[model samples]
Target: MFSRAVRPAVRAGSLAVSRTAPSNAANFATLREIEGRLKSIKNIEKITNTMKVIASTRLTRAQKAMEDSRSYGQTSNTVFENAETKAPEDKKTLLVVASSDKGLCGGIHSGLSKATRRILQEHPEADIVVLGEKAKAQLSRTHPNAIVLSFANVCKDIPNFNDAQAIADQIALLPNEYGSIKIIYNKFLNAQSYEAGTVEAYSEEAITQSPNLSAFETDEETLANLREYALANNLYWALAEGHACEISARRNAMEASITWGFGPEPD
Candidate 1:
């Protein structure tokens, strides 16, 4: 009888152990699911690494071009500064805004567009010239009354002096037709950061009032020559910066795509 009672107690303990076994099995299953996700993320990281390398190579070339053009840009600005001193009193302000044609660079295009919008709000009557499709699309919605000169697909391909001249011609002629000119573009500071620089054409009154007239010692003929040079240089700077921005954006997009398993192959 005592042996029979002991057997019943043993059976009760066995039932309790069996009940807890399923919980341990469930925990193991959860761990396996987590491990699978981690493995997927690792694969994605490898692809992103490859893309980053490619982008970095392109960025170096773009940086060299930007650096090489600095002196010319400074000289051109000096000429414009001098011309502003003698420019006529009545002139409309023209705003030229540059942005990338495509998206996915993590706030670059949007930030540039936002900066442009702020400038437009500040100068309500300014004529607008857009260098990229993205800027044109975004600005057109808000500034319906602002005149937009659209340049499509200029950001992706190699930008040359002719491209710069075309844009500069449009900008330089604005003073005769409108009054003054301004250029808004992203100055590439680093791979991750850019400064929104606004280059404005100074009015005659503003130029006369300013004390910094000593830098420009050129006559009318030289001043005209410098103006052309400066416009071209400015356009070149904008293009170089745009190229850097494109690479940065593509790198960022590739990273995101890798993380999500949506981008092209890493090569």
Candidate 2:
């Protein structure tokens, strides 16, 4: 009689557990999902933080380079500025788009493409020479025939004097002649802003015909050399400034991406 009583109690306990089993399972599943999401958030934040630091380091170096390069370039062009030399009044010109090979920054390279298109509309006969791959890709789609020369890896790292010199030498070697060369680049104003600007590189004829050329002690040969050197210096300044702008833009972009990632996911 005692054994029969014990059996009824055991049956009641089994029934209670069976009723609550599904409820326990549901709670465990919810907890696991939350844990997975937290792990993902941590990983994503780590990646963004790491990239931001790298870009910040590069930005500092680039800014220093930009300052020094600007000084050197302006010194070289002191002759043109002082002589009041002007570009020829012809529409035919060489447009040297100073962009970079790498990307992932905001609107910098694409902005160059838009500026180039605007210039092309105004000067349809102008020839295009791209100093970096990013602008080349964007321009090729719209103005393939206009591009004569395209360079890659020119802005892979901080630009140097030699890099600019090499590019200037190649431009000099082109068979087609241009009255002037316009170097288009992003002028970094502040961390949050940059504007597209053009720095004119005068041709040999323009340099020689300057109203005040006779004031300088240099001979014709030296003047020719100076023009070439000036082109290289101006290009270096543009490349360095553009690189700095790109790094700053990249840091901002990464931070924004990380913030968006951590936001609540859609159901």
Candidate 3:
């Protein structure tokens, strides 16, 4: 009787141990999965923080450049503004889209795209010259055939006169004799704001036909050089301001990310 009773107790204990073993193993596996998720979150936080720092570092330089370029661009447009040059509605138009290849900058590119679409609604015959892949992709969705030229690998850094000159040279080479050239870009309003803006480059005929052209004494050759120079200058200004806007937008996005706990808690 004692042996039988002892054998039953042993079996019961063995069964309990087997059941508890699985429970322990399951708990360990759950803990491992939790640890892995925490690790991934930490890694994401690190990357976000790094990008935030970089954006902050770039913001100052970009703003300063934006200001200087604004002055330069305004001065370049003085002649046209003074002359009251108007684009001829009868001729075809060219739109130069100033956007970049990189994306984490919120709606900077999309805003420009929307503005372009709105302008196209007004001038459906306008041909597109996209400066960045981001804008190209966005415009291609609705206006694929309108894209006359799409450039890549631009505005990755602060824009310079040389970049603008190269782009203007390419535009000048296009087969169409565009009546007007308009550059669409993001205008930086403040640290947390930006909007779509346009900078116009008048054609030689438009400049010559301006109602007030008689106020400035110049020849055809000089007018041609001025047109090229002004186009490049305006392009440089637009690109610089757009770059600043993008940096600011990126910084704001990072700030929002951190606020939403995508990064480490603020100190």
| Model 2 alpha-carbon drift over 4 Å, by segment | 1-38, 262-267
- Summarize candidate 2's per-residue lDDT along 1-267 as a digit string, tens digits: 549869989899999988876644653458889999889889978987888889988898999999989998888788898877877776269999999887667788888889989988878999999988889988998999999998988778899999999999999998976888889999989877898988888888888788987877888799889889999999999998988888888887777777776421111
Q: Candidate 1: TM-score?
A: 0.68
Q: Write the per-residue lDDT of candidate 3 for residues 106-164, one digit (tens) a residue.
A: 88898999999999999999999999999999899999999999889998899988999
Q: Choose the strongest candidate by lDDT.
A: 3
Instruction: Give lDDT tens digits, candidate 1, residues 77-97.
Output: 665565444434465667878
- Which runs of model 3 end up more than 4 angstroms from their true locations? 1-29, 262-267
* TM-score order of candidates, top first: 3, 2, 1
Ranking by lDDT: 3, 2, 1
Full-model lDDT for every candidate: 0.69, 0.85, 0.89
TM-scores of all predicted structures: 0.68, 0.83, 0.87
Off by over 4 Å in 1: 1-51, 79-90, 172-176, 201-219, 256-267
The local lDDT score (0 to 100) that residue 6 gets in candidate 2 is 98
Candidate that would win on TM-score:
3
Error of 2 at 44 (Å): 2.4
